[model samples]
Target: MLNRERYRGRLIDHIGLVVRDFAASKAFYTAVFKALNIPIGGSDERNLWADELFISTSDSDEVEGHLTGRIHLAFQAQDRAMVDAFYRAAMAQGGRDNGAPGERSYHPGYYAAFVLDPDGNNIEAVFRGASERSAAAVRIRY
Candidate 1:
């Protein structure tokens, strides 16, 4: 018999986003990361020597000048306090706040905060804990 209970999946490794101008996108992502106090892993800008490449000069051009199909990306936070800090920093760095740091009961103790990046991407920081629900309830009820 297999011991299914012993199986545990590790956290996510990394995420990728295609940008029109690598320099501009790098700067924007770097700013948000600095605000959140998350170290950037790495990035690169290389020309693809292939035929089926659809490279564009800018993100808007890549997406046909419309902010459609916005991408949502979330990062794991160490704790609720970290989530709060991330939200504050993001707002301070010109990120638009979508949701404040608090519990999302719909997700079972999910404490998260959301923000919009310079390019209108939805970014979030989240932590998992039961205390988050109680705190959220207090804020909501009061």
Candidate 2:
């Protein structure tokens, strides 16, 4: 067993973002994902991935030389403190603060922080307060 586990039934199976500069984007994302406690699943000169997100240089075959427009992507944080950590790490890695960590009216306990990635994509970390889960995720072994 490789001890692999993944949360299936997500809205998106995967998403690829083509960036103008892979090196810069890679550095920024590396720090950001670290704060989120997500591992860098794999990488090469052209692409790096963490979980469902794949980032690559525009020249990559999957990207087809097309750079994606600025988009908002929100990651789930386990708690409020993690959201703050995410903001701090992002800022340290050249991420611009779009919004500081705070609660919003989106729901009763929607705590979130936003930052613009190196490519100016809006990235957010949010904690939806305490909740229940049936299981951590679907486990797969290889």
Candidate 3:
């Protein structure tokens, strides 16, 4: 069994993505996550997981020979520079740029960048200006 710990965020429990090309998706996400300063919690040939995101090949039990539809996931970044790094790393790892990093009309200091993952999922890195969080994450062990 895979030894792992869970870090819960404010609103989401977890998200799973089933991909066709596991290796490509893994490489793409690994680089992108690294740029965002998130570590790979645990992984094997069939599974890759981080804090709240779980990715698997279609052959995995959770996938059962199925593929997930394109979905959008926005990750939090420390600052605009991190968002830029995410774009650069993702581009070097087969990610397509959906949107360049910039302030959005969503609100002031809403800096973010968008990229399409190997599976065409819209992935994003966003930095919402200066703010404070209650905690880094809620830790859970199993």
Report the error of model 3 at residue 84, Å: 0.3
| Candidate 1 Cα lDDT to native | 0.56
lDDT of 1 by residue, 13-116 (tens): 22344444545445545665665556543333521111111222234332254333477888667678888888887777667889988989767879999988
Q: Please, what are the lDDT tens digits per residue for candidate 2 over residues 1-142?
A: 1225544656688788899888888998998899989888778899988777889988887668588999899999999999999999999999999999999999999999999998999999999999997776654444
Instruction: Kindly provide the TM-score of model 1 when superposed on the true structure, using C-alpha atoms.
Output: 0.56
Highest TM-score scorer: 3
Which pairs clash inside model 2? none
Pairs clashing within candidate 3: none
Candidate numbers, best TM-score first, in rank order: 3, 2, 1
In model 1, what lDDT does residue 75 have?
A: 67
Between candidates 1 and 3, the TM-score winner: 3
lDDT of candidates 1 onward, in order:
0.56, 0.87, 0.91
Name the regions of candidate 2 deviating beyond 4 angstroms.
1-7, 140-142
Off by over 4 Å in 1: 1-14, 20-28, 34-37, 43-69, 130-142
Query: How many clashing pairs in candidate 3?
Result: 0
